[model samples]
Target chain A: MDTTQLLKGVLDLAVLAVVADEDGYGYDVVRRLRAAGIEEVGDASVYGTLRRLYSSGALTSYVVPSDEGPHRKYYGINAQGRAMLGAQRKDWDEFAGTMARLLGTEGGA
Target chain B: MSIVDDAIAQDVRTYAAQVRAALADLGPEHVDDLTDGLEANLADALADDRRAHRGTLADEFGAPADYAAELRAAAGLAPGSGGQRTGGAVDRALRQLVGSVRDIEGTTLARLRATRWFPGVEDLLVALRPAWWVLRGWALAHLLLQMVGAEQGAFWLPSSSGGWVLLLLAVVASAQWGRGEWRTGPRWGRVLRFASGVLALAAAILLLTLPQAHRDDVARAQGWGDRPVEDGVVVAGERAFNLFVYDADGRPVEGAQVFDQAGRPVTTEPYGGDRWRQQEYWPDGAGDPLFHVGVPGPNGETRWNVFPLHSVPGWAWADSGAPLDVTDEDVRGEVLAPSWPFAAAAAVVPWRTGPEATLPAPAGASTPGATPSAEAVPPSDAPPATDGSAVPEPEPAVP
Candidate 1:
């Protein structure tokens, strides 16, 4: 798959994981994603995904008004989102271990 | 100077606007930076394309839908199904509808804004800012004079027309103020200045023509009835009475009545006319009376009048059985014969030129069946004249 497509599939997991640690506004999420080496992530896409996830009951949002500009909506993962993250992590570990074994690497196994 | 460059710039602007609209659902915090970056990139791309003498902007930038898709992807949302999106047709139709509605609304707004007084007095202030201090002083003085009721005082004085003169002065001042181009210095401006001057003059004239009223005044005046009376005679058959009357201004009067010889009014109320009431009446009523009469004018002119009923099918004029002592003079003066279809169909028997002509018809002579010779010809072979100019030749000068 293209890096963009691969990146898209993991974005939800990344967002939940980031907000899993601390709730963040759209810009904060974008900054964290960029810092984490996801250079292809766009500010708009992160916000849209955050809203979608929140609407799908994985995340909840709260408004924090700023004197500098408009109010900011912050997102944090809910119980269902945390459970989804745990399942994704487990699936990733299993896949990585299987790939290591197929590659005949002790570290992978 | 380059068409390509201009087109590219326009495309950039248009694309930017579209992007703005599409991303409006996204909160400003989320999309503002991305949208700004996109606009900058789009502009640069268009500029670069123009420099390279590339193909059309549409070809260069790709299809708008594809661009929107790319933007949506970059924004990190799930990509829409590349497969046939349900409601795609409906969505396209709705977008077109919204676009057309927006275009119409925009045009209407532009037209309305182009009218005077839009952008308003602030624009006037900006344009006149150079002479602001002097104009302000003058305005203050003018208002002070007005506050003391100078206009009313001038009206009561011997020089009663001073108010008009003052108005003319104000108009001249306004024209002069509009004449000064201000920022560009006092040079002859374009035709717009002249137009403004003309408008000011028109406003002055309108003000002068307005009736001045006093709040203290309580009395008022009114006019009484001055309607005219017209008379006519219809000899049965179908007839159409077209009443013509004008007001003092020679305007057509509306809503006049036609009365039968028995003093019975036979016309639809609410007739229309400029000066006198005009109406088309049919003699469909019973007991064919003598002459049909219309109300007389204030000038005592015969108010009600009728003409010989035309013989045309479906054509009926207001009528009365009253025997009119109509000589060639009466027919020549007011009541002309009905034209065409009516003339060809009605049996018009001219009364004999003698004492019998002046005498009332014998009893029962007004009976309908007694006048069979006067029956309007049904399907007469009268060819409708072509030029409408061929006069009927005199009947061989009867010996």
Candidate 2:
């Protein structure tokens, strides 16, 4: 089963979760997502999510010029973003738990 | 940078520009942020020591408009083809036109840079930007002045006409003092400003070349003589072509330039001056009749508007040759026609001086720039009716 559709639904959750732990710029967020094993994550999608969250008052953003590369706009999760991240994490946990049980892999079958 | 690296950098910039063009209708702030991000990523992608020199960033990221669409989506904006497709009917049409034009211009520019047909077009356009920018600035200034009902300009500049003097002054100022910003060395701001200063010079030249009067000034400066024909008449073969001014019948009766049936300027050249058989500009071309004459169009601008000259008449108009034995009827029937394929394809039927006319003998039918020893057909007498037939001479001196 393709995880792309699933990732799209929880992109907001995933972006907030990543930024909640530590602030990151657009490309940095993409790199972090890839490192976290979400290979399907697109760089542009992370950027869009950051912007959307910032516009909705769920994230704080700032610009920092880099000597090594182009200037970056860093996005940090705020109170509202943290709250939404927690709620979505709980929802995803419950859903995943139900799905796992439905699969009946109790003894590593 | 290596040539390949430089080339890739240019391609990247072009891609970024395409993205910018697609997002043009969006507020500048939004567009800027997105483009900035895109550029930063591009720099990282190109500069990071890992990726090999391989496919273009465009191939990886897709086309510019597609990338822009993705960027817009990432920014939580509507899809490019949806609510954000642009405004009303007129707006949509304009956007489509702009999009197509931008795509065409950008792709063609990139592809043509290395081609013989438009070599150096890319660099030339880039260098021409300063002139373009300065002119645009002055034009804006004029528009604003008109809006405020200012009839006179502040300096010697005109409210409407003489903004080029203003542009030249600004370019001179920039070249002189624009380096002040760069005195501190090549920071982003200093380097950018330094680059802009280079355009000021280009702008000055662009301004200088903008008008017909200025073009004439350039010609005079180059000592090509502003106008060659006197009183609109050129005495090529004892008969004159009144090219510039009108005759008594209020028509251009004579000119060194001859037109084909389709009104194409026939080619000609003078043998005495410059390089014999070398093409020269119109107005200046009468002296060297080997080249077709160039003229300013109905608009004051000079386009490549040389009427294609038939090679035979062209040669005759040369200093060493005689006038074509043609009448007013021949001019209407052959030279004034709307197309020239027939005129070009038809056999060299010698102009009829009477009911019985003979084609000029090959020995006497030599082009003006041809050997002077070759006898030329006289203007008044028809060639002797040898064999009572038209002689088919080998066509030469014409492509």
Candidate lDDT scores, in order, read 0.46, 0.51
Lowest-sum lDDT 10-residue window in model 2 chain A = A62-71
CAPRI-wise, candidate 2 is incorrect
Off by over 4 Å in 2: A105-109, B1-5, B47-54, B80-399
**What does DockQ come to for candidate 1?**
0.04
Best by DockQ: 2
Candidate 2's DockQ: 0.17
Query: Over the full model, what C-alpha lDDT does candidate 2 score relative to the true structure?
Result: 0.51
CA deviation > 4 Å runs, candidate 1: A105-109, B1-17, B20-399
State the lDDT at B349 in candidate 2.
Answer: 50
